[model samples]
Target: MAARVPGPRPDEERSPLAVVLDVLGADEQRRTRIAWLYYVEGLTQAEIAELLGISRVKVVRDLQICRQTGLVQIQINGRLAPCVALERVLVQRYGLTQAVVVPSPHDPAHLPATLGVAVGAWLSEKIGPGQTLGIGWGRTLHWSVRALRRREIPDLTVVSLLGGIGRGSEINMYETASRVAETLGAQCYYLAAPAYASSASLRDMLLEQAGLREVLERARRADIAVVSVGSLGPESTNRRIGLLDEEELPGLEAAGAVGDLLCTFLDAAGHPVDHPLNRRAVGLPVEDLRRVPTSVLASGGPEKVPIVKAALIGGYVNTLITDERTAEALAAG
Candidate 1:
């Protein structure tokens, strides 16, 4: 018999970390640019080659040289501000890896758009060339995609974490991913199925589809994941898109559902509440998502506090993006 496999581990993370550290220590300008172009500017080797008037093979060599030397450094904005202070507290309180707190708007209606700007900019800086990103769809995520600046990130891939909503819903999973991909001139992988299946068997069949399977696997392998929470309100995509039958809403709430992520309902404690819909949902499971290297939970609004707090507490996300009011509210709780 072959060797037995043990439990899951992050042993694979060490190689990339060591390579990046070595790349950042080198003083060579071209090697530095190769790393910067790929990791910081999100350009692929081919694109960098074209821009620098070099061969694609040479571009690959230069990038490897970057890894051999020391070169890449990413700095988040650390200006001392009220929001920054709140971000610090949130990280400390929740054991978060990072937080991006925006100023609260007086008119709470503008909260999503305002926070969207912050998150969009943060994403552009965080994603590297030849990287993968998993994005969940919702109103806030839609706004964030719209706010993102158009730029090239060569070989970048954006994946839809959930399946589609209604046929024409503006914030469907595919729409969010395609919009971002268009902005970055990148690639995309979309699950070509509805958010939920007619039955658990049907959901299983859909997931086994060749194309969708590839997308789901890629989503699980993503280095960065950005997702949003959906409150259990009438305004939610589930209700608005008519995915949830009128009678089902009451049962979900009675089952202690506070909100949802990737169309899978979650309780106030961030555990998936027992519901029939979960078995039929065609989205990435929360457990699989938690294994992603960097998870960014971008959401705001008073209604989302419970779910957001739950997500953070459950270790679903390492980073958070929200407004000051929501931050303070989270702190108070």
Candidate 2:
């Protein structure tokens, strides 16, 4: 009579796979047991063979079979696992519908591309036939075009939430909207004016124009809105693009402004600052952004943490896509 091999000790830690293996067929159980002992338990192949009452050659062949038949799988526990955990915490903490936390790139310069691909993949999944997407423009959004999958969705429309810049660049609002629409093979709508009007009266005039009003209305009614926050620091895109004047920075800061969403400055507590630029900017109101069914905020980096938090606090973003480091900072705050 053969000696019965002992099963796992009662005090031993069992992986989920170990628990499920009890119900497998005898032959399958043997194969998986050998695999478990060799791979998970860190037993030498000779020890596994000896413990399972199998020859060393049989142990090797069974381990091979486990791999071939999908019984053995390997997953590295790394940054991705922490990222998933962060995603869960962010959703619960911020009352968000969803949160996507990506692993930070090794090179800080690659951050935009990292975030861009994530947003691109998310948009590909969310946007569909007959859907209207409203979008804000920035460097990160410009990079998103590189990863966006081109697909023709019938009746799909893309509305630029902000007006264009006089100085043309790839990251310009006009170019961003046109690129996104072209990539998705969707109809495109532009605001048909500069991002900021020359004067408050001119802004009002542009808002009342038949064509511009039509686009703004389309933006207000969009099924989804994707936007990014801008810091009030010296490196702010708004300043570089001439949307804001250097002399106005001190006044905005004195008014408690920390960042801007769609060119509307917001304070630490997420209220709009009492600044002339907010009134003069040509775009969808931050309040209107909240009304969109799905408003996605995509931005990252240490510099963006404050603004991102303000946006989250203001209820401007229901969905967030950001890097692991930024997610950690937000969670810590």
Error of 2 at 304 (Å): 0.6
| Candidate 1 off by > 4 Å | 1-80
Best by TM-score: 2
Candidate 2 structure lDDT: 0.89
List the RMSD of every prediction in angstroms: 16.7, 16.2
Model 2 over residues 1-333: C-alpha lDDT tens digits?
Answer: 999999979898988876776667678988978988888889998998888788999999998787544466443345578999999999988999999998899998888878887888789879999999999999889877766767788999999999888886768998999989998899999998988888889999999999999999999999999999899777777878776788989999999988899988999899999988888899999999999999999999988899999999999989999999999999997
Q: Highest lDDT, which number?
A: 2
* Inter-residue clash pairs, candidate 2: none
Each candidate's lDDT (Cα)? 0.83, 0.89
